[model samples]
Target: MKFTSEEDTYSWAVEFGKSLQPGDKVAMFGNLGAGKTVISRGVCKGLGFEGSVCSPTYTILHEYPNNPPIFHFDLYRLEGGADLYEVGLDPDYLSQGISLIEWPERLEGNDPGLTHIIRIEILNETEREITLEKI
Candidate 1:
């Protein structure tokens, strides 16, 4: 869907968040300044999380405690697949909470099944086109 503003993007994320279940993995694909973090913040709001939500760029991952918890990961700086494994991001983490991964193209795996892939393309400074593909 094409979002003309950040509010529209957040609205789409809120709607998407309503359908998420524990253990759901959402892989977000986008370039810098693509508003991935904005969508994530909206998901946090939709999930009833009161804490601040920001991109896990330097930290790599940020875990938020909601009813089921949310695991937000930014693999943009990861060196390789080994880094992912070293961080204990195996299938086990997927069973504990919702996994939202940015820069998931660095992941070394197949479909991983039943995953939601969100592709965001920047249309302008404040506009974006988001495509949610279920796999």
Candidate 2:
């Protein structure tokens, strides 16, 4: 799908979020300023959460308060899956709730339960293409 505005991207993500269940893991792919956070917030909104939904680029992880919880992770600064495990992004930790990971290419091997993947391709300053895949 193509989105011309952030609002649209977010709105679509909200609906996507509604279909999520606990333990559902999502991988988000995009460059800097690619509206990944916007989609994350939309998904949270769909999951009946309302609050700040910023990327955890520095902190690496943001746990939102919710029934099942939302584990938002940013691997922009991480090196590999070993770093992920060190930061508690292991299977045991991710199984507790929904997990949204950005820059998931850093993940080594196939982390279980990572069934949903979303990739955002920038078409221009205000246009983007969103692709979703399930494994």
Candidate 3:
């Protein structure tokens, strides 16, 4: 998808969120300033989260108490998959809610049958190429 602006990116994510199901896991790939958090906030909005949706880089995870619930993870600080357990990101937690993981590469060997892989690339100063691959 070609997004000319941040709003476009967010709107696209909202539409993408409509297709999401409980226990669906999304692995997001993008460089810094690629609007990852913006799209994430949009997904949260689509999932009925009324509050702000910020990156959980420091906390590692953010859980929004919505009808279907949203689990946002930022693994930028982790060493590898072995640290996921320490953050309480076990099977139970992932299976019970919609998960969106940023920096998914940090998940060494963890692969819970990801439903989607979203990759955002900077096409220009004001345009972005967002690709969603369903698995």
lDDT of each: 0.82, 0.88, 0.87
- For 38-77, candidate 3 gives per-residue lDDT tens digits of 9899998888788989999999999999879899988888
The TM-scores of all predictions, comma-separated, are 0.91, 0.93, 0.93
lDDT of 1 by residue, 12-125 (tens): 897788788888889999999898898898887888788999999999889999877898988888765535566447677666778788888766663434379999999888
How far out, in Å, is residue 61 in model 3?
Answer: 0.3
Please give, for residues 1-135, the per-residue lDDT of candidate 2 as tens digits.
999999999999999999998889999999999988999999999998988899898998999998789999888888866455676677887787899888888777646568799999999999999999987
Query: Clash number for every model?
Result: 0, 0, 0
Off by over 4 Å in 2: 110-112
- Indicate the TM-score of model 1: 0.91
Where does model 3 exceed 4 Å of error?
Answer: none
The best candidate in terms of lDDT? 2
- Superposed model 1: Cα runs more than 4 Å off: 110-114
Task: Evaluate model 1: give its lDDT.
Answer: 0.82
Q: What ranking emerges by lDDT with the best candidate at the front?
A: 2, 3, 1
